[model samples]
Target: MLVFLNQRLVVFSTPKCGSTALEQALAPMSDIVLQGDPRIKHCTFHRYKWRLEKFLQIFDDTPMATTALIRHPQDWLGSWYRYRHGSWLDGTPQSTKGLSFDQFVEAYLAEEQPAFAAVGSQARFLTHPKTGETVDFLYRYDAFDEFEGFLEARLERQFDLDRVNTSTEMRLSLSAHLAQRLETCCEGDYALYDSAHAPRPKSRMRAFMQALAS
Candidate 1:
């Protein structure tokens, strides 16, 4: 995660959502960069707001905004499957070595997921625990250019992001049953992604006041 104190912006890192590229590109400009552990570095919005932010009370009065990127649930799982299946993880318990994508997804949807299919949900990462509110800005992985443009304008700097931590390319296909199970189990992720692309609502009271004055 990268925090810009002057800008009052916090970029929450969502796993397998191009976070490495973002971190590499923005770390140099950030005031506080979390890099000690994967868990701390990729701290979720809920954790940051409830725990980390409170702990860092120096910035309590700062008007902060949060941002995150999310990918399609199936594609997110596919990335995890390919990454764990790589040669580097061949002998590890987390290795997806002998498993097909369908099998991996089945494990993912199981009540108790196998080590290889235990990646956490993106929707949960960006949401508030009690209120169910998401980040101030949520970007889709496929629409990164839009996110990049917004960041550039907000930070007053241009970014030339390099691709990092990319998994090997492979064609992934899910069985109908596995796909259905994934959709049912990860419905929140799909809903969050859809919400990210939706248009923001106008303030009805402001519009009403303006119309009355006119």
Candidate 2:
């Protein structure tokens, strides 16, 4: 996660959403950059608002504007499958080397997911559990330029981002039945991505402030 104190912006790093590239590009310009562990590096918006932001209040009282990037659920799952299939993870329990994309996705949607398919939901990362509030800004992974442009304007800096931690390129296809199941299981992810275009609601802002105060 990258926090720009002057900008009052907190960019949550959503998995498989090109966050690594953004971090690398903006780290030097950020006031605080979290990159020690996966858990801390990719801290969720809800967690930061409820937990970490209180600590930051000693330094700054500025209400942070949270942002994140979200990808299509199917494509996001495909990235995880391909990433685990990489040579570095060849013999690990997280490896998806011998599995087809459909098989991987099936395991992901299972009641108890296997290690290789246990990636957490994007919706859950961005939403507050009790209030059902999401980040202040969300950008679609497919429309990366839109997000980049907004970030540049907000930070007043040009970004030179290189694609980092990209998975292997392959044409991934899911069976119709499996695709339907995935859609049903990840409906919240799809809904949240769709809602990104709308303005943040007053209730969401109120809930966020309440959470911060609590």
Candidate 3:
């Protein structure tokens, strides 16, 4: 999580999203920086809205312009699978050494997900559990240029993002059947991702209101 108090911008860290590179580039400009611990770094939108976002209102009491990136669901699980399959976690329960991507996703869809497949749900992370509100700005992970343009305009400085923390140990693909099942079961995940690409006239007004308030 990052807060640019002057800009009234809060950039949420969605796991397996390109947050590390953004943090490296934007940390110096942010008034408040939260990183290091995965939980803190990957703070959920709801947690921020209900807890920290409200707390920060003590300083500047207006709804902040928030932003987050979301990736395709199948690719997200692939990242988790490839990451845990690395040599570092070879012996741990979190290791995914022996499993194929299909099996890994199978475990993920299990009622009792094993440690290796316990990656948190992206929808839940970016949503208010009570009100079902998500971030103010949602962008597709693949279509990062649109977000970069927005940030450059907001921060008034052009910045380049470098690739970091990628999971390239192996390339794995999910079977078509399992992919369909994942899509069916994790409907919200797909919907959240789809929203990133949807037209957002309401969000533009929200951003306008935020600018006026600030």
Candidate 4:
């Protein structure tokens, strides 16, 4: 997470959402940068509210507004699968070597996922612990240009994104049955992603809907 105290802004590091590159680009301007460990780096909505928010209150007059990004649920899962398949994890139980992407996804949909496919739910990350509160600003992960514009306007500074933490690319197809199961299991993530596109221009929103349908 990157917190700009004077600006009352916090750019939350959503997993697999180019947050590493964002932090690298913006860290110099932030008052606090929590990263390195995954837990610290990906400070979720609940963790921030229950722990960090109170600590930050000592230094601020008002609560900081959070900004984050979301992606299609399948895309998010694919990223995790590819990331775990990286050679760096070859010896670790987290490695996805030898597993098909469909199999990895199957593991994820299990009642209890193993380490390799235990990528947590995105909905749980963004929603409030009890109240289901969402971030003040949520953007589609692909909509970096608009997200950057919002940040630039608030911070009054220009910025750019660099590709970072990207994983290997491969075409993997899922069975229709498993795809249906995934739809049911990750419904919350789908809903949250859909919400991010609201209030978009008619042309853009229509195009987005078409893309989703396709």
Which regions of candidate 2 fall more than 4 Å away from where they truly are? Answer: 198-214
State every prediction's TM-score relative to the real structure.
0.89, 0.90, 0.90, 0.90
lDDT of 2 by residue, 64-103 (tens): 8888898888999999998998999988989999999989
Residue-pair clashes per prediction, in order, are 0, 0, 0, 0
Cα lDDT for residue 128, candidate 1: 84
Query: Least lDDT summed over 10 consecutive residues: which range in candidate 4?
Result: 197-206
Cα lDDT for residue 95, model 3?
98
- Whole-model Cα lDDT per candidate? 0.87, 0.89, 0.89, 0.89
Predicted structure 3, TM vs. truth: 0.90
Q: Give the lowest summed-lDDT range of ten residues in model 3.
A: 197-206
Q: By TM-score, how accurate is candidate 1?
A: 0.89
**Taking the tens digit of each residue's C-alpha lDDT, what string does model 1 give over 1-214?**
9988788788888999888999999999998898769899889888887887876666567668888888989999999999998999988989999999988998989899878888989988888879998889888888787888878988999989889999989999998887888888788988999877433344999779989999
lDDT of candidate 3 over 109-167, digit per residue (tens): 99999999999899999999899999988998877878888888988899889999888
- Model 4 over residues 1-214: C-alpha lDDT tens digits? 9999999998899999888999999999999999999999999999999989899998776978988988888988989988998999998989999999889999999898999988898899999969989899999977777888889999999988799889998787788898899999888999999988433455978889989999
Compared with the true structure, model 2 gives a TM-score of 0.90
RMSD of each: 8.9, 10.2, 8.3, 4.4
Global CA lDDT computed for model 1: 0.87
**Stretches of candidate 3 above 4 Å error?**
198-214
